[model samples]
Target: MRADGSGSGTLSRLEIDSLKAGVRIEDLAARYVPSLRRVGERWVGLCPFHDDTRPSFNVWPDSQSWYCFGACRRGGDVVDLLREAEGVDFRRALELLGGPPAGATAGRGWQSPLPVAVPRQSEAEPELTCEDRAILNAASEIYYQSLMTNAAMRRALQARGISLGTAQTYHLGYATGRRLARYLAWRHLDLERARCLGLLHDRLSGEDGANGDTSGDDVWEHLSQRLVVPVMRGWETVYLIGRATREAQRPKYLGLALPKEPLTGRGRPRRSQGIIVVEGPFDLLLLHEWGYWRQFELLALLGTQFKRRWLAHVGPDDRLLVATDQDDAGEAAAAELMAHFPGQAVRLRWPEEYKDVGDLAQAPDGHKIWARALSDA
Candidate 1:
């Protein structure tokens, strides 16, 4: 809502070029830009120019410019970085960098357009230690393997109309109590990491301990007869293990066993290509079935209720479409989604005769309904 166009003490191309050569791009970006993170040697962050999380936004310390792989496709020196991040132009960025003493233009407050308020991102994400990334990847690989060959689990997914290919693509797996625990231990995972990731738990005595022994119930508790769906943080499964209801369970639904901290520390990345927010897990799965899978990745809120904290995770350019059920509860959920996303959110209501995604999938115009909602762009 606040726009400052006054342009003054801008950094000269020569000075910016010098800074790029002198400072590490990651260091320079962290010092000037908030919320940007150090991915490897290069500094990566959400693209302020658009909503995306592809890690496509890159800052070159040598050139002192930034480039977003998403919509803006912008690439320039530090001047350009400031412009995109602050919604300013080169002159204004020069003023910001030159500081008030340099007679540059007056500076404006740095604030994100998203609803939640926070200090600009500080360069504080401890780089993912190799050990950490390895542990996570290993855990994920094992879980993924389980989803493939596990007999009971495969049957459960089939019953839910989910295909084997879907399970594999999402890296889904049932937590066969002993196999998962053994896998973690084999990888030399510390007790804390396994516990924090929600992969370890007590099944035997109902004792509250991380990495507890799994009995028949405990393995099933994490994934028993349920349809398992993995929520990946990039390539790693951060949280989420689900199961479909057993035979004829009235309120048929898949559920998530969130990590110890229900809200993980990381927030949504900026500069994602786009976002598709649906009410249930299969709604995301169903949308994928309709071919909106690539451009629009799905986010299942686990339910219809909107969490206020979720607003902070939204990217500026990201478009969120709500695909709720045709029932009253679905309508209520859709209203809540619009309350948060406003014009960016469109309710994907089904036809009068159909119920929800499940019914639509079973109905004749199912493909048409999917086509209508996805092409709403």
Candidate 2:
């Protein structure tokens, strides 16, 4: 609950621990540990932590923990359980499970202390919240995991000339939610937050319509049908863009909206004075995979829908490299963006045959291609 008494919910660590301790591991596991089966009071699931056809994963209801008695033995408390099940970190687990542990801050100052060093909201952009990152990370992880497991994404990558090993190395993932509303509901995410972040539609009827932007639902409605690429700022999954796999789908690509809630800058910085802007996530991943990321940091508009102020945030001293696709759309988008940076923007040109940085990376003369792209700028 917030101090203003407006917020309706809270996240308590004790409550989470109690939920773990009281809830039957079998029942709890059944709810979230996908691909798991319940037997008597114990739950047996395919160990996500290990490779196993046999069910060796066991959960202890009383202990509020799970253990995998397999080659890749792994298990721990409910926190660990959620971490593995959701593929997220501790902070996110805390968010999903609800507030911190009871009495953990019992002795803390009662008086409302000095306001923490909050992020100053940009007048141009509404303040984003810490919860926004939590939702983004969770969604990004789910989409990424889907890509790793989806057969179509792998085939699509191959068709694009990206090798299987390279795809995994880049942590490529896909989104295939048969229904966006159901996915968001399962995660306990508020519909407004999803709508605000451009994850769900506002006019879907029922509870969804109350949220807003019925049109945005069209973006995620085809997720299970698209190739998802996560855009990470440092370790935090801040933004994502989805590309449709089906040839007939209209508006071939979609991006998550810029978060309107206040954003918390807790993790390490993910930008640099030198930014290499790419049109697609695969190209960004390819650059990072090949150690080219360090020479020049990578950033993406996720597409051309970026606000003009987004470019304004880039410091005047920073170097901006436009590495859009070699095709017509890429060239046009690059031309528009180049006009924004003016003196700071440098265009990365390549052979007419190469369509993107990923293509250049895979070329027989990859190093030379990169050199040429860098030099031609």
How many clashing residue pairs appear in each of the predictions shown?
Answer: 26, 20
TM-score of 2: 0.50
C-alpha RMSD by candidate, in order:
17.3, 20.6
Write candidate 2's Cα lDDT for 306-333 as tens digits: 4566555678888888888877557656
User: Where's the lowest-lDDT run of ten residues in candidate 2?
Assistant: 204-213
TM per prediction: 0.50, 0.50
Tens digit per residue, CA lDDT, model 1, 36-123: 7653223566555566544445564422445554456446655455566678764455444443334434333333222222233545
Global lDDT scores for all candidate models: 0.53, 0.58
Q: Quote the positional error of residue 64 for candidate 1 in Å.
A: 47
- Model 1 quality (TM-score): 0.50
